[model samples]
Target: MRSPSIAAAASTAVLMTLASASRGQTTGGFSLDRFEPAPAGDAFFGVPSPAAPGHLAPRVHAMLDYAHRPIHSSGDSPIDLVSSQALLRLGASLALWDRLLLSLDAPLAVAQGGDDPGIPGVAFTELTAPELGDLRFGARLRVLGRDAGPLQLGIGGYLFAPTGTPAQYTGDEEPRGAFHASLGGRLGTARSSLGFLWSASGGVELGGGPNRPQQLTFGAAAGALLGGDLLQLGAEAYGAAPLGGDLLLSSTPVQREEAGLNAELLLGAKLRVLGGLTFGAAVGPGLTNAIGTPSVRAVGMIGWAPLPQPDSAERAPAVAAGDKDDDGIDDALDACPDVKGDPSPDPAMDGCPPADRDGDTVRDIDDACPTTPGARSADVTRSGCPDDRDGDGFHDGIDACLDVPGSSSDDPRKVGCPADADDDGIVDASDACPKVKGTASRDPKQNGCPDDPDGDGVRGAADACPNERGRPDPDPAQNGCPRFVRVHADEITTSKPVQFIVYGKTRAQTVAPISDDLLREVRDAIQQNPDIELVEVQGHTDDSGSEEYNLRLSQERAEAVLSWLVAAGVPREKLVARGYGFERPLGDNRVKTGRQKNRRVQFMIIKRKGAAVQR
Candidate 1:
């Protein structure tokens, strides 16, 4: 058993809907009574500040609009013949925090009644439209749209104040006092809201008392921006159903429980039109009673919203791409771009493969043995390569005899290519007495020079007795009065000291030879001196042949002296013979007299250990 007032409320709802359909060509933005007036569809234009460093601020919106809701009814209809309506709406959005938004919607509605005889003077009366619809206050909590691209979403609750006609508005049921709970979401460039409303105190009385009904409304809109995201074109549709009651229409309480439908087409644009300011305009035709009998409603709206702050996160990726080493060269084309790399191989060649002179595996710039093939090494002076010469510890530049194996660390003087030991201007290879002092008189190719005649350490050119030995042998005018003495073995006795001289000659002009007379004279002198306890025989020559050959020749000449001494019955232990090949000299080597002076060897007795050394 349902209450009669509840039934009458249902019927009156049907009549209001039928009357709106009976009139055609009306347009307006959606209102709570007609459709699920969402958290203003335009509110989306002001999405929260991007998750960057700033805030979305306060926003204001104002809209002036009019809607004509025309009604047509049957003759027995309890509702008036018809009524037309006009509406104005204004609102604003204030950001409460990063996640919550507060909004207020105020509307002013004006109505003009249709001609009807059932109510007297209805056309002449001043109908003020019941103070229009009361202000709607709402709050939306942003749950998940910060990064959710164009599809913004939210949930909110709205309250409509009791400002619409209820007493005089017999045909208009559920026209005042509504509370709506809305669940809202959006797609790219589009928004939608669905709400369940509890209407209070607007339906007809039931069982001699007032009755109220609950309603459900779904609203949805989809739009596109014409130029960038700046200009927008959108269309919205809404459906609502009355649940608990109907309005009494005719005397029969015409069952008016019904559903209503409305739609609006909007044209809006988002413009920077200025700094940080976004302005939009919306003009559309709203359809009313559109579920079964759709009627067109007209609406015009203008709104201005603040633009969101720019996002800092969007700039991070660009900065990282410009630098590769973090040194600012974008690695793709960097050539030798590693500025902190090690020192270059060659200061002139840059840090690349060095130039190789020889076709060796080692680069020439780094190859110590640049002319010879060798291994790559880290010897920077040798262009980072290693070279071994003489098969010894020293490189070729320091090795005196590069061809021979020599030790730079050990016996350097003994191992290098040989040289003349004496000052006779001859290398040892060509000097007759290589180790002993000598002259440069004889042929330098073989034995360098002959021996000295007098044992006074002077050769024939400087000695008075050029053929004798063991005498003063000075200039006769200055220090001598004796002539040459031919001595027998008794005259030259062992009890007395005697002089021995040996000279060198050569058969070939280039091959110097030992002097036969000089050799015999020295042998005879030694045989007569038994008291000659100490004998020193030195061989001499001029530079000839190689230093090595000269040195051997001089050594052989000194040995000849020792052999002759032993044959003459002198003890071999009493004589010390040495070769000085072209080293010590008695005269200048450039002249024939000097050559003769360089060719002789002389012997002297050592009377004491400190005896003066004779040439």
Candidate 2:
């Protein structure tokens, strides 16, 4: 049978270990404070060292600990003592604001056992009962760094209440208070794969209970992050030395007296299983002879914070699915879903600009002259404004003298004070001989007169054929005439192709109808230029469908156009039709707009000897 004093003392040691662990001190038991094993994963089963990181959210942690001591001594006995203890602790902490944290911990002594010698101060024989432990509440305020820094500092105070059966060594059976300051920091680089942390704390307890002597306690811990912060291996050394008080045999001896030191080698792992839930485990063995230090200790824990979950039920059912723009894209995925537009890679421009109805680069909301077409520019005064090359109020589109500044006017044809190059009263646009001054006449055609280049007797402005000399006729239209006709190559070839509207059962093989306006132009050109021998009408199409089919279609279309021209008035001998098909695409066929421009008919003027060719 063990002495009551010895049993009490050993049990007290077990209780002390449990208390230290719950308080996040390294003395014994499992510290339930906040220690981050990884940057994102915190220690779940052990009290965080003073150097641990601070959190922004509230967290609850629960841990189960099992400790076994193969050998221990209480100074009263020369024989070695053996014991086992189990503790269940529940702790919660919340960061009230900034770096301030409030925490509470409660533990239950599930089981305890050992060889008892019935020492004088022992309170119980063999362990056979389970009971509640003391309750500890604390507030920690970080004075220095909270989340990240080379060094972190904090000050904290805790209150302990007698809530357990003292006979079972669960508590001191009295109220006690303690104040402490902690300084900790990280060594090596957190940015590096491997790093280390060092923490130390010291404080004094104040109370009058037999177990609550006014003593000083201090602890230090060092740990290293391994395997990319997945594992933490460290060591801790801590103890309490009585300063001045009546000798409290049970409580004080369990934590060591005067200047005794306890050491432990620890290993732990933490895993972030969910958004804000973490699970961890730690196991270690004591390396020094200390009253409360256990030979081997193991702990398992689970921690959770509610605020990190975004997909929780609380947030569901509040979002709606709809498309406001009717652009085939949903509002949830569209950047500018309110306005209809095609898909674009840029999020800001994912939809069409609402105010730019005409698809102009300038937005109508900022465009001063919204109705008119203009260029986009970075110049503050000119941006979104109509092009006024000469800084004149009138836009170039309406200004007759585009290169010179002039006053604005209501006349549509006389914008920018239409220039008279020859100093003629009439503007260049109205003057037939703009470079030479002329006299006005009653005839509208002769209003702006000029010298007759052909010496046709009639003025150049009134002569129908100013370049050719002819006998003056009574009728103004036939005053000047040319005996033979001539035409320039440039007059036949135009920038815009002759468009044909095709209609048939098959789009590719359809016979296209030539425009009457185009036919008239071709006929007039041939008639005026009697010297022109041949005119080749070439047809081309975009790359689509069968190449052979496109070639045949192109040839047929070219022939159709030439036939229409011939029927309109052009002689067959002067016309030749050919097809280049999809091989002569003028633009990219992959896009809709490019393909539209690629389908066209081209006119090439072939002149005989002595006739000038523009090319």
Candidate 3:
């Protein structure tokens, strides 16, 4: 019986040749099954590698595995299944920026099963194939991993190298080393890997050994991570047919076929059980055959894929602040954050509704000039708006005749509001003839009417008598003036003023002074004269006292007559005063009674315009 070493080498050589012919064969636990659960940066779950810093994923991984191959063959052929293989892996995933990733897989193995025969159920009586007995290395470079619509695609290539025993058959021809390449991608939760491989298999000739020819094969694989990323379960099947079926040249032409069907069921879990140390396990059972051998494989892996770095990728893009439509527009202050707003000035009001200036109870939108601050009842345009229509600092509605401008008059028709026609500041309705200009007056009936009385040549409106011009005409009608006349003597309208006083004799030295009624009588007489503009008062005193004292006393007496005119609502400017000492007295100052009579006040009339009054 061959030693374990010989057995292992021989078994490995045979497996190697089969493995080469079916380069795309899927191994039980780790051969081209796409153990890379997900491409470094895919959005299978969310933002691929939410753990990768700037998509740079730095990881260290290791795997220990064991496989048992059981061989069987069709009639007329012999089979030897005797190989146990173990492999270890350690590598870093350099996620270069965002676009690419570089990976390396270094494997070390200790394989020892081979056929020396003499063992029960062993299919081979003699071992004659080259067996693999050395370390192997492989590298993967991912060229793309980006969002394409709803799919995340990854394109990459893988290479494998052999550093193991080559010759096992009597006339061995299988090469000791080999290389392979592959591509992969992932969409949603599904992942797929494909590869095309070429290699040399066969050895020297003893009884005409099979030719170790170059061959090409194609394969496809796919998988998915279930539960969370921590637990994954998948299945993959691969098959390959040689590009050229002429693997050997035999003397007789016997149809030779080279093809393989490999299928595996894998279960793995990444347990973050102890801090950063990840305890991962994978077990796979061959379903079809890997290079025509029924094999069972189990892989146990423990790794620390270091904590994902911060400053990873740029902050996942803030959800876009204040963005309503997910479009950024601060609603609190957004005019039209959702939809583009009017390009006009005030962004706030541009998007929002504007304020109305008029108290019209209408909003700016419906209100033409929203800022038109007008009165509530103002006459507005069709849009319920106003624009200083009359330009009178007033709005239209309450503004009587909206178009026609009017002063403070009472004629609502012709005068916008009501002009103080006659400029008297009194409307026609309130004025006797508001249309006819007249100054304001206090007399009820004559408030704004002209004070014209008689129908003589001179208008009673200003004539004193108004019908008569001469002095003391008792019957004014026959004296060129009408019997009844209109008079306006308001403080603001009296044109002229006059005053007069009469002296009376006291019987038996007892005299009654002139009363306010009498003084008013004298004033009325003077007022009736249109020629009187103002009145002057003179007083005389008896000379029975010192000249200075008598003079002062006389002045006091004259002032008494003037006071009556003023109290009658007569303008003081229309009256004047002076003292005529005893020198001007008509009554003799010799007797007491005579002196008292001489001490009296007299009045005279003055003429003035615009100030003229008629009776």
Candidate 4:
């Protein structure tokens, strides 16, 4: 016979179960119908759902479940019973390590109600109750699948503590444990609008309690993600079957049989919000005729998994200490902490300027010539001076003549001085005749003088007859002289005069197209008449301007003609240059044609007899 207390407790449990169902609540315990929260959509119930290892952090979950059994038969009996149940549960889970997870949960039977028959051979079965349920703790370890892989596998176990009162139908009044293995995976497009996932699990429970039996539990679920996983819809099918146990009848004597198979088909939806918060709900109907299985069940849950915070020790040292410029130097040690720079011994300069690749004191930013080695100087213009390519004391930029060695003066004209413009080995500034090709000379005035083309003893510039062979003379005027002038006796018998046309307005104006033939003729005459002792070059011009000017002009023309003949291999000592004003004319001065003829130079010849000749 059963004790009154036990009978009353059973009756109370039945009433509570019915009330809980009416209130949309269900009790939690070692039951085939319990749900497990997991990363996959199928995790709504009946499986050790596989998850990518370390993909999620610790989380807390709250769930409410309601179950209704409008009709249920016990064993082979035809009698039926109606009941409602409600339960609220709180749970937490954490990834303890690489592929390991630990979780704990507690449930409260909040409401239940149903019709109840007194226990066999017992009375006073009416009751009232709201009580705590079992405490569940579990660990899950991933056996396969990395965080980013499509296939995942895991094995785990759960321990249930009988923490509920029997009167509430919230617990089995005995401890229980379960071991499970699960496989899960995602299909379709991950992180896309059409992504999907599926999960499946199987496990065995070691039953320990009066009338309880060892059981096999298996489940599978599939889901589609809408709105990028913000919303999920899924369905699950799960079942449990007893492996072995003694046949037992209900304490009320309504039926007698061994444990039967229990199964359900559930559809669920979850909405993820606030990045880490998830709200979910599910409903399903029983698929079997098991005594304890409800005809319809529904569940609602809210879960949160706050993002993990990095520990100080786990954070990078540079980031933790603050490298504002990301230069690997902390702000405290960086002179220009906010700007990128380099390491240096000087506190004020370290990290303060851009890199200097050649170890030059000048930073590359301010160094105009950065690559080649240089020096710092007070001249800002040459602060980053390039190497002197010519081995000159002055560096490149300041030195105008870069490729050749020169002076160091900054004066535009003097700087880079002593350059050999003609490359004659003589420096240009000291070169009297810089442009002409020449040679070094001991005489400063004649230094860099052009070659003596005629092989004359004197240098070119100082030689009076530079292009002709001649002997040196003490007199500057007769320095390079030919011996004598040969002339015809008839030419010396009279004063011979050469005529010319005056083109310039002044006597000193330059003349164009002087007759080389005429000059050569005069030179030949001088060479032919060797008996001529002396020659006089006289000037005469037409009266075109003032008498004074005309006289000067005539005299210049005479001197020019004399110089021309002397330069054309004539004897310099035997020649004289004279300029006569326009005082004598051979033609009418007032006539344009006559004035042209009169504007002329005349040469006079004298014999060794000292007699002057007139033409």
The Cα local distance difference test for each model comes to 0.43, 0.59, 0.41, 0.61
Q: Write the per-residue lDDT of candidate 3 for residues 1-615, one digit (tens) a residue.
A: 123433343333333223322234321111322122222222121012211223555656566655556333322333454444454445445665655555555544444344442323222323332333323322233333332212223334333433333322112232222223333433332111211111111111111114332333333434343322334333333333333322221112211233243344454444443334666565666665434323676766666554322232323334335546332233554566665322235655534544554656776545544555433334345455444467664445445667655554345444455565446677755665443455567754455655543334443223334322223344532343323222233221122222222222221111124254454445555565545576667767777668898787667656655665676766688787778777886654533456667766555443456554343
Tens-digit lDDT string for candidate 4 (483-591): 3321334342122234443334443333333455455656766665556656777777776668888777666786766666776777877776666666666765533
TM-score order of candidates, top first: 4, 2, 1, 3
| Candidate 4 vs. true structure, TM-score | 0.45
lDDT of 4 at 487: 34
How do all models score by TM-score? 0.37, 0.41, 0.34, 0.45
lDDT string, candidate 1, 573-605, tens digits: 877877788887776453346656776555645
User: Ranking under lDDT, best-scoring first?
Assistant: 4, 2, 1, 3
The clash count for each model shown is: 92, 20, 44, 32
Best candidate according to lDDT: 4
Q: What C-alpha RMSD separates each model from the true structure?
A: 44.3, 27.9, 44.5, 40.8
Better of 1 and 2 by lDDT: 2
lDDT of 1: 0.43
lDDT of 2 by residue, 478-542 (tens): 55543222234443544345554433444322434435554565566576556777888888898
